[model samples]
Target: MPVEARYALLYSDYEVTPCLRIPFEKFAFLILTLPLCAFIFCIIYSVLFHFESATSTHCHVYNVLPSISAAIGNFSPQREVWQTAIMLQSVPRFYIAVIYLQFHHAMAYPRDAWMGNFAFLLNVTENISLIILSFWTSSRHYTVHEKAFITFILMSEFHMLLTCIMQSRFKRHNRRSLKWKRRLFLTNVSCIILGAYCYMRHNSLCEPYMYSLFAFAEYVVVLTNMAFHTTAYFDFENKDFVLYKYGAAITER
Candidate 1:
């Protein structure tokens, strides 16, 4: 069967203007903004109100920024804001994952289609792990939260790497956006390494500002990850998210 015939099976022959249609750019904006605002809110709230606990570590080292868990785990409004953001963002994220899978598979060709699908799986697992970690705070469900966080980090890093690799293979696939995505992926990986080192050193020596370095690195990792996702805006620049009634009459404009 032809591709058009396959698509036709999913939709009716009638034509109608969508009741709700949002451009991918606008949708991507929401995807980018929610977490960013939550991150900023949680960090500022932690610094201003929950300073001692937020920046504290096992070794009692002084810190500049709080770890993501510290900022959003135990706090009241901070936790709530973070949870709300994640919950809201999750729906669009799943949609974006499906879109990316199709986009990658179609553009990269069937020979490497498995890579695209695997990347999609990684994206979904990463999102699920994020949701798990957001709800299960280390202060409470320590083991569960820790495991979820580790999974989230691993999945997120690998998803970014795989996505960059897939994009690099497509000769005409938005080279400028791919350029920034690859750059951000490298920076994200660097921050992850730096954060790990700082965390280990802080625990071993109980240094004054080592935990701060870890916190800063963690923040950079998050920022770079967000920036990488932001490239999706360019990826689907002309696309629209539509919700239309399938059998509705086509009214003349």
Candidate 2:
């Protein structure tokens, strides 16, 4: 019998519940694609509006890359587009949090289980802080926005570190999984280095060049995160999960 058919036969009394217990790969794909699409749309909109030329002064032509925040903030013509991107990205962020939480719960390793929980906490914190920072633009709530931005960055880095540690543990246990984990670790390191360089050069004397670098670095950061989650597809590809309602009895398959 097929796996699904056999499982169905074993639990004839149970009805399949409609829930978000989707395949890890599918969930990860959505998490990666949605934000990417949103950012691409925001970038195109910003360019079409000539946001930089509109804001440039006598001697200073604003570079669009470093000015992403400014482009999305109150004064920019593409503020609405930026906010829309934020809103769209928030959906994937929420999905990622839930998916990872479920992933960790399902694969509860006795020794390093807490690492997964900690990573999930940081992930949630980063996403919440990002949403808060996006809505409370620096123009109106500068202090609050700055705090949220700093919190988001800190949490994101810590989350990535924890995830790397977790993947390392997996690699030690299952040699077959090492390939993706190795790639993920490299990507994480690259994100950290690029992020540091972007930070150091953000407001330097060569503003335009630094801003462009910052923009590209930020894109790499996002792509690195997408790659990290994409590895989960391989990690959990063969595992099957059956979720039960609260207080309902679960029969082991």
Highest TM-score among the candidates is held by which one? 1
Residues 37-56 of candidate 1 have per-residue lDDT tens digits of 99999999999999998887
* Residue-level lDDT tens digits of model 2 in 54-114: 3343337356553445545644545665566667768656655655665554455768778
Error at 2, model 2, angstroms? 17
Q: Give every collision pair in model 1.
A: none
Candidate 1 least-lDDT 10 residues: 2-11
lDDT of 1: 0.81
Task: Count clashes in each candidate, considering only residues at least 3 apart in sequence or on different chains.
Answer: 0, 0
RMSD of each: 4.0, 5.9
